[model samples]
Target: MNDSARAKPLPTPETQHYWDGAAAGELRLQRCQACSKAYFPPRPFCPACGSRGVRVFAASGKATLYSYIINHRAAPGFTAPYAIAVVQLAEGPRLMTNIIDCPQTPEALVLDMALEVAFQKLDDTITLPVFRPAGA
Candidate 1:
């Protein structure tokens, strides 16, 4: 595909740090200092208590399959039969990401399966967070 046809990333001030971390192969998240809660989709304030003193931390990139669906219909920039998954990270956040490094069939995906983070760089400024089966 040409550069113009490739997918573009949407980065806002609140999400810039997270995208930057992904470019460096790190999973970054927002943690509420007061409640000790970790969350994804970086925000300006803590969702638990509306506190603005949240901190950014690098995650271990370990997660478990929370839920998912096998999409058979093709979209503008995606192929058919891809797995769209919601992964529950070990740090206490659920991230929406794609399941890669395996077949997109029902037999290949199981609930609560262990997964590890992987990245797909689409452009100079965007890196997508994907997941794969975890090792022992």
Candidate 2:
């Protein structure tokens, strides 16, 4: 799908830093200072420990394919035959994202494949962090 056709994310105050980091070509995630666990879908408090002492940091941007499904039906802003994927980050957080730079096929989208972060700019304000096969 074209970049303009993709739905833009509405950044909330709590999630503004995440969007900012994406625009700056960084994959930022939250880490709990209290429990030393990294997480996503940004929040002020740690889900692991319920501590507000969470800190935002740039992630390693390395991940492994955890799970995915190839959606062949066309939808708003998304073309058919795209893989909706869950990738486990090196820091231990798994997030839902799209896989790009490769064929969206069952054979191509292997389980446990190594991936790295790639930014797709939807506009001036939003740059999404998608993933692609590592070294591809």
TM-score winner: 2
Candidate 1 lDDT, 62-135, residue by residue in tens: 99999999988766567788888999999989989998888888898998999999999988889988999998
Instruction: For residues 1-136, write the lDDT of model 2, one tens digit per residue.
Output: 5645667889999999999999999999999999998888899999988999999999999999999999989877888978999999999999989999999999999999999999988888888999999999
For model 2, the local distance difference test gives 0.93
The number of clashing residue pairs in model 2 is 0
Q: Quick one: best lDDT, which candidate?
A: 2
TM-score of each: 0.93, 0.95
Candidate 1: which stretches are off by over 4 Å?
1-7
Cα RMSD of predicted structure 1: 1.8
TM-score of 1: 0.93
